[model samples]
Target: MTQYLAKYFALHRKLVLPGIGFFNTSTQPAQLEFVEKTLHAPVHTINFWQDENVADNNFISFLIKETGLNHYETINKFSQFITGLKEKLQSGVALKIPGLGILTNNENGYSFNPENLQQYFPGITAERVIRQNAQHSVRVGEDEKTSVEMHEMLNKEVVKDRWWIGAIVLAVVGVAAILYYYLSR
Candidate 1:
């Protein structure tokens, strides 16, 4: 029965046990670590809440379909399983839901400790590669521009700032020419 619940939770990413609460699975997308130069794998996390008021219609329907049992039988079987879980929790035994995590009844409420399944997923080395002259799309405000175009625009601004250097060189050349001509004469 625990296996069925775990299988259903794995397939649907959600489960709502009528008398207990709800379980939900959320995924964090793979991320690139700039400092480590590695691409981390995506992570799937399960969360549980001990709200007795939550509905379990979808879970009941899924169980009915998977177990080949009628609605009443399915509900009965599921309730029996939940009753066992509740009894264990009430007796101070932590319930370990396979493939999910451990659940314990704390002073406040039910506390869930999710299993660390990261050992099954591995990350790969992914170094950042940026080509200097490579043309790529870049978003600048509301407009899209290419890398090469932006590079040229930036260089033009730099050239404008250094315009005085060219003027100073021409002035020095003119002064040398004038001195040479007067000395020759």
Candidate 2:
């Protein structure tokens, strides 16, 4: 079951270890780190969501196929695997999965101890852009632009970004509907 989980994690959208925790992937966008003074390329990273034994969208579907078991059987097997993993985590054992991470649970919270999986973000190989001239600053003082103005600018950018995202989503949805319509016809 653990090996099946490993394959599922490698191939699927999400993994649910019922009663343990949920795992999902998220993008850490390419951004400028002020403290580090480096522009990091976007990276895909796994996040551990502390959730109940409740099912998620992709968990059971992957399990059904990977385990080659019926829905009820897969669920039962998944539940057992999760119970073991939780026990291991609570007992201070770091459960390690390749390409994923070691998971450890302390008194306060459970954490996924990912082992350097960010070395490569799948399908994205943006070169880390660096500045040769490390020392440079544009101090936007109150005289040039007030904090309120800067905030307003940021708000406008947010709205613009939201509009673009909405447009893209609608476009995708529209295309999907059209394809479905034509295919069904």
Pick the lDDT winner. Answer: 1
TM-scores for the candidates: 0.65, 0.52
Tell me how candidate 2 scores on lDDT.
0.72
Assess candidate 1 and give its TM-score to the true structure: 0.65
lDDT measured at residue 89 in model 1 versus the true structure, 0 to 100: 85
> What's the CA error at residue 92 for candidate 1, in Å?
0.8
lDDT tens per residue, model 2, 46-84? 888777655764767877976688999977877787788
Compared with the true structure, all predictions reach lDDT values of 0.86, 0.72
1-185 per-residue lDDT for model 1 (tens digits):
88888898888888887667888988999988888988888998888888988886887888888889999998898888888888888888999899889989878878899887676788888866777677889999999999888888877844347888899999999999999999999
In model 1, what is the error at residue 44, expressed in angstroms?
A: 2.3
Clashes per candidate, residues 3 or more apart or on different chains: 0, 0
The C-alpha stretches of model 1 lying farther than 4 A from their native spots are: 127-185
On a 0 to 1 TM-score scale, where does candidate 2 land against the true structure?
0.52
Predicted model with the maximum TM-score: 1
* Candidate 2 Cα misplacement greater than 4 A, ranges: 29-41, 120-185
Candidate 1 overall lDDT versus native: 0.86
